[model samples]
Target: MMKGLYCLQNAIKWYEDRFCVRFTPTVIYALYPKEEEYGWPQPWPNPDSAGIYIFLDSNKTIVYIGKASQMGARLDHYFGYGENGKCILKDKRVDDISYVQCYSCSQEEPYACLSLEEYLISEMNPKYNKTGRTEW
Candidate 1:
């Protein structure tokens, strides 16, 4: 049974890669709104804060990791429409989303989320975080 599950997961991952869709734990959690007593609010403000997010599938596999200057905006872009093939939600391979908020070190200091993202990506070795592992 374990072997079969692994094979199925690998096959799904292969299809996702072919479609350029990445997954991580954070991404999986963000797909659904948090349960609220008063329901949900409209027009959620974009998280202007910088942060690193991970994308995961239903099985909780770390498929992708990314850093963003404006976490909310970047996430919104994934759900929004586009013609240049930058939208991950449109790819249909990603079924879930989640994110972690990162606070700045100081008012003047640059965002540390990028560094954290690099570290996590390196340590986890996610399949979709290829750019960070390469030198320009």
Candidate 2:
């Protein structure tokens, strides 16, 4: 939703203003669960870019923040079920995630991925992230 993207935009601005560096994400996609599937979105728009992703609850509250070098594969590892129909076990919070916001930057922006992820986790205080959360 826009609220989630708003937080991301704010995070980008905050990081740039504080560090005096540019952090621009090239592709952003908001994915909702499929009615008949139990895996990451099919035909993911970006499979190789390094970036950060946010998990949001049904109410559009951000619950988790994560980063990966391969955004599509990382998401598949979480949402994809095995041939035996078993999900790769992860934080139980995954079940609470109803939507995912993926922000992918160019391969040249790996540092941007890491720093932005940290900054967003700190500012948003997503419940599923264990570190960098600011107490409020």
Candidate 3:
């Protein structure tokens, strides 16, 4: 887990260095609820925003990377039993989630969240990200 965390930390650093912009991730732990549980635990991370969300497994390895214009609604669609629960976290339970929230300035430049998502996906090669998964 430490190794995975270390790699992730380095990946974040690499993203910042390569992009010349630093996006600090807010890590939320124990967000995944069990089958018997009623719902997600209290004090859920503030999701009413836009950004990139990273799904991490028990070993702190990133399993998936996604971008959403509406973080809360998108998350709810996945976790709120919508669409028959056909979401990435269905089988691969997330031990925690880390998000970097940002609003893009304009279309003249690439969106920060999209760039970050793609970079992280390519660098980390998250298991569930069908797109942008690289050999690295």
Ranking by TM-score: 2, 3, 1
lDDT tens digits by residue: candidate 2, 106-130: 6665787777788787777777775
Give me the runs in candidate 1 sitting further than 4 Å from their true place: 1-28, 32-46, 81-88, 92-107, 131-136
What is the C-alpha lDDT profile of model 1 across 9-68, one tens digit per residue?
A: 464355345645432212123343456411112232335555555555445466666666
Worst lDDT 10-window in candidate 2: 23-32
lDDT of 2 at 4: 64
Cα RMSD for candidate 2? 5.0
Error of 3 at 96 (Å): 11
Per-residue CA lDDT of candidate 3, range 26-118, in tens?
544444444553224433244655666666665556766777776666666545333533233433354344322222222333367777777
In terms of TM-score, how similar is model 1 to the real structure? 0.50
Q: After superposition, how far is residue 44 of candidate 3 from its true place, in Å?
A: 3.8
Among these predictions, the greatest lDDT belongs to 2
Score every model by TM-score.
0.50, 0.69, 0.61
lDDT of each: 0.45, 0.66, 0.54
